[model samples]
Target: MVEVERLFFMGASQSSSSNSNGEVVFKTETPVQFSPTLVSQLADRQNASPVPTSERQSTLDDQIRAKIKDEVGKLRREEEAVQKQIHTALEKENLDRERDGAGELADGTDSGIGAVKSSAALMGDLEEIRGKIERFQVRKSLQDWPQVRESREKLVECYRSHKASSLECWKEVEGFKDSVRTLEKEYFKTLQ
Candidate 1:
């Protein structure tokens, strides 16, 4: 469709208007039409640009990674808590057995570690620890059995010296967990 806009300038020649030679000159009216297609094309050009879906997806992926990392951090913290519990347990068992003198009793306290014969779950932990101990043993970190025996004697001496202290330590490491994994990294290092 043709759209016309009119602007009137009345009395151009008769109103003392002059030409380049200061002489009156007659002029005719001209028509101008606005093009709808050109206007629509200009607007469409702006809208035709691509959307940022890839950029948006990258932002979403980053958010997902951050959420996963947060969940993993929480799980790691829980795992550490469980390990500490196990450490305290083994330490107590070590002390009690020393006191009561257990030659070969198949303690039923930890069904997870039945009879010290390497039960399924405990065996895996034992194997992992054995690897670490092998490395530590190479480095001479863990004491020999004789030295451990001497240390056990000293532990008893300390227990005798302080009455409630041994029991206190036992309270922290109850159930004699019976798992080789009950040692913390630092204590395992000592075993090497």
Candidate 2:
């Protein structure tokens, strides 16, 4: 004879049985149902309000502006630190060269080749650091301009436009960036 049974589990259940044929069976099940009352309760929960597109765009713009400002400030700080390092190096090199000169004079053997080479190397390093600072200053100046901000905004709009392809906006973006680069180069050249 075959036996049949019915069981109801609220959440989850695991059952094992041995049939008359000596075969073992295991079954696991989870009983879940969405009740109308639960649905009504869920519907009653307050949802987060959505920000308007214009407000969101303005917020994004503000964030971008702040980020650019932060980046520029950081670059300026780094440039200042590099300048300080260069100055410190120059001072230390001068002091060392003075000590070497004094020692050589006392020894009656003055081979100033080493000192000259070191001074030349130090000058090269200082020049490189000055170039970096000049470039950074030029970039910061470019970023500070209102026209650059307007161009950026236009580029952003072009990218965001539904009818425009991103590729189409690349020219404007590259043009503005190239202009900034050119300005930096010209400014650096003037320094030289």
Candidate number of the best TM-score: 2
lDDT of 2 by residue, 100-164 (tens): 66435455687555443455666987899999999987887645666666677777788888354
lDDT: worst 10-residue window of model 1: 1-10
Candidate 1 residue 143 Cα shift, in angstroms, is 36
> What are the clashing pairs of model 2?
none
Q: Evaluate residue 10 in candidate 2 and report its C-alpha lDDT on the 0 to 100 scale.
A: 22
Candidate 2: minimum summed lDDT over ten consecutive residues — where? Answer: 1-10
- Compared with the true structure, model 2 gives a TM-score of 0.29
Residues 1-192, model 1: lDDT tens digits:
122222223444344466688777665465666699988998897789666579898998999999999999999999999999999999898777654542345563444423443245457878999999799768643343344445455556666777865765452233222222333444679669
lDDT of 2 at 124: 89
Clashes of each: 4, 0
Runs in model 2 deviating more than 4 A are 1-52, 103-192
For all predictions, the C-alpha RMSD in Å is 22.4, 27.3
TM-score versus the correct structure, for each prediction = 0.28, 0.29
